[model samples]
Target: MNNPKFEIFKAKNGEFYFRFKAGNGKIIIISEGYVGKPSCVNGIDSVKRNAPNDNRYERTDKTDDYRFNLKAENGQVIARSSEGYTTKVNRENAIDVVKKEAPNAPTEDQTV
Candidate 1:
């Protein structure tokens, strides 16, 4: 992916979505899945930012009950809540986690 970067946005559903760009702008946009948790849009986070519910990654469009987790360059997590619902941890909580996990996170724009 060219010109890859972290982009955060709110979908029409009011749910949050983060996009991780690569060298060509190619990226993965992960959202909340059936497991009732958030996921990361980028690839790095898939490891460090695991779902609190099960610490797994899901790939499906049939349900927004799963999740995607992204990792900051510093090693923090950036997870997105499932659409149509919010997690008990909340965005702020995710942000705190990201801060803790990725202290020198270069992708601060992609908050967990």
Candidate 2:
């Protein structure tokens, strides 16, 4: 069976970003754009470090959807949900999945 993983890539604007994907290949979380790969990698590390801590997740309730951001100890957002969930329950479930799966997910550098 496929396991969850992180994929790093460069955007069309030449910024680097990384995304966490479930075993089913759906992108669950994505990092903000960085000027360099090193910073992007650091963001991935932050995600792995913080994903296991429920307190590090910041939940948001938008007008049309529920969303979340995973933050570092310094309050900087390391990554955020790729898409808002239709229901708060679904958002919470996705947070639970990240808490369970992100710590050990392998990284795949697709930038090259």
Candidate 3:
């Protein structure tokens, strides 16, 4: 079975970001771009620390889809859903998966 992991990569803009992928290889959560890789890694650490808290999730429903943001205790948005879900159930499921996977997910340094 594929293991859920955090992949850190550098964007073309020279910023770094990290994405949490589920065991199925679907990206569930992605951090905002950081100017440095260390900051991006810290973002991933924050996600692992905050993901299990239900209150940290800020859910939204747009006209066509549902989305969510994972926030740190300081109220900073650590990560956001990779894509809007077509249904509320799907969005919740994605959040649940992140909560379950993030804490133990190993980091894959793709920034090399």
Candidate 4:
């Protein structure tokens, strides 16, 4: 099985962001842009430390789809899953995958 991975890139707006991708290369979650690369790395660290905890997940529904946020201990949203899960179970499974995959995921710099 392929391990999940995090890709870091410089956005067009010149900010840095990281995206967590599943083993098959599907992006499972994306993070907010940061002004500096160090901050973006910190965000990745936050996800690694926080994604495994059930309490750090905040679930919500948007119209017909379910979405969730991974939050840090201080309540900042570290990353957010893409919307469109039709059921709560699927959304929870997505979160579970993040919990399972994030800790050992490798980081790739795609800023070039």
Q: Name the best candidate (by lDDT).
A: 3
Ranking by lDDT: 3, 2, 4, 1
Q: How much does each candidate deviate from the true structure in C-alpha RMSD?
A: 12.7, 1.0, 0.8, 1.3
Model 2 C-alpha lDDT per residue in residues 75-100, reported as the tens digit of each score:
99999999999999999989988998
lDDT of 2 at 8: 98
Query: What is the lDDT for 31 in model 2?
Result: 92
lDDT of 4 by residue, 24-54 (tens): 7778899999999999999999999998899
The digit string of per-residue lDDT tens for model 3 on 12-93 reads 9999999999999999998899998888888999999999999999999987699999999999899999999999999999
List lDDT for all candidates, in order. Answer: 0.39, 0.93, 0.94, 0.90
Model 1 poorest ten-residue lDDT run: 28-37
Best candidate (score: TM-score) = 3
Candidate 2: C-alpha RMSD to true structure equals 1.0
Q: Return the TM-score for each candidate structure.
A: 0.32, 0.95, 0.97, 0.93
Regions of candidate 1 where Cα sits further than 4 Å from its true position: 33-112
TM-score of 2: 0.95
Better of 2 and 4 by lDDT: 2
